[model samples]
Target: MSIQLGSNQEPPKQERSAETRRQLLDAAADELLDGGFARFTTHGVARRAGISRGAQQHHFPHKHRLVTAAVHHLAERSLQQLEGITSDGSLNSTRRVLDALFEQYAGPLFAAMLDLSLAARADEQLRDAVQREEHTVNRMIDEWAHRRLTGCDDAPADFDELFAMAISTVRGVAVLRLLGHSQESVQRQWKYTRDQLLRLLVENRS
Candidate 1:
């Protein structure tokens, strides 16, 4: 099964196949957002997408595939959002991107991901996918940190550890925010925490 998003300027008529795929994905995301991952079943995705169960199965054979695809879709959207941050060609770009990401996802997205991780304990495939996404996000964060470190050409040997620490710090804020902390308070504390983390990274740079 293939997924496509047809261009609006193509013609007067919308493509049915493309529209169906979009609906499926969009609806799945909405379901995940509305309820936790446990609440997101294949039937629920189909109902939300307004597509037949057979069609959903054609695209995604199982619930795990649908969930993994949704994770990838969200990751791609995030990368797109960071495109500008990457292109800034300044060390601050790294920090800014991290800040923006935490700000954007500290609420619902982070909460949903946490829910998914807890759900993964009983599902091996889901556990693997969640781990994969964690590693991918960590790699991105590590690369950004390396770029921003004082010596970009020769980062510290423990760069990964340091990067993981910073990621944890941000994720802690996300959890707190998701649990009803005020946005103003989260942002205030987050900025201070980020600055301190960056300073430490800079100091540790080889």
Candidate 2:
């Protein structure tokens, strides 16, 4: 006989599975941030997640898969946050867009991405995974920028190139933060870069 569910009953199996995966990915991201890829391990992630090793292994069979999945998970979350920020009607200015993008790159997500990227350089398998995810995320950002910045189906022919440069510049500024540059110095440099990018965007659209 099937048991009747009560208020204290556990969640359904599918939901529990999804929650476990989320926990593992969150733990994996923290592990990467706390200890770069060189020291990242599924065991450590499982420990951080407060789950058994078997459980994490059941979800992510290998270290590379776990790490890459963690990066993808974090990237998706960051992109969602960006979408939310850009959706606000009051923030419909080029400078605001740049600010949102800069804030995105300056967060822990980018720090985790940097860790994966550095480690990927020496690991062929991980490199492929990281590059694939990077390409996917970049494409998503390109589409997002086109839609948000232009608000039209037809963007300028050079729009993508110009946005790519802007993103690269912002990412460079983010690296400065990771490199231990003072907050004041980073802000000074970003202000200069932001103004230059704003000018470029205006010229490109004009």
Query: For this target, which candidate reaches the highest lDDT against the unseen true structure?
Result: 2
**Backbone clashes in model 1:** 0
Give candidate 1's whole-model lDDT.
Answer: 0.70
Which stretches of candidate 2 lie above 4 Å from their native place? 1-3, 87-92, 152-157, 203-206
lDDT of 1 by residue, 1-206 (tens): 99686674454334766677778887786788788786789899998787999989988888887876676566555555655554232347546756765764574555667788888999888899987875675466446534444335545568668767776777787677888888789878888887887665554452
Point out the worst 10-residue segment of candidate 2 by lDDT. 84-93
Per-residue CA lDDT of candidate 2, range 37-93, in tens? 888989999999999999998999988889888887877777787776453222247
Shift in Å, residue 111, candidate 1: 2.1
All candidates' TM-scores? 0.70, 0.83
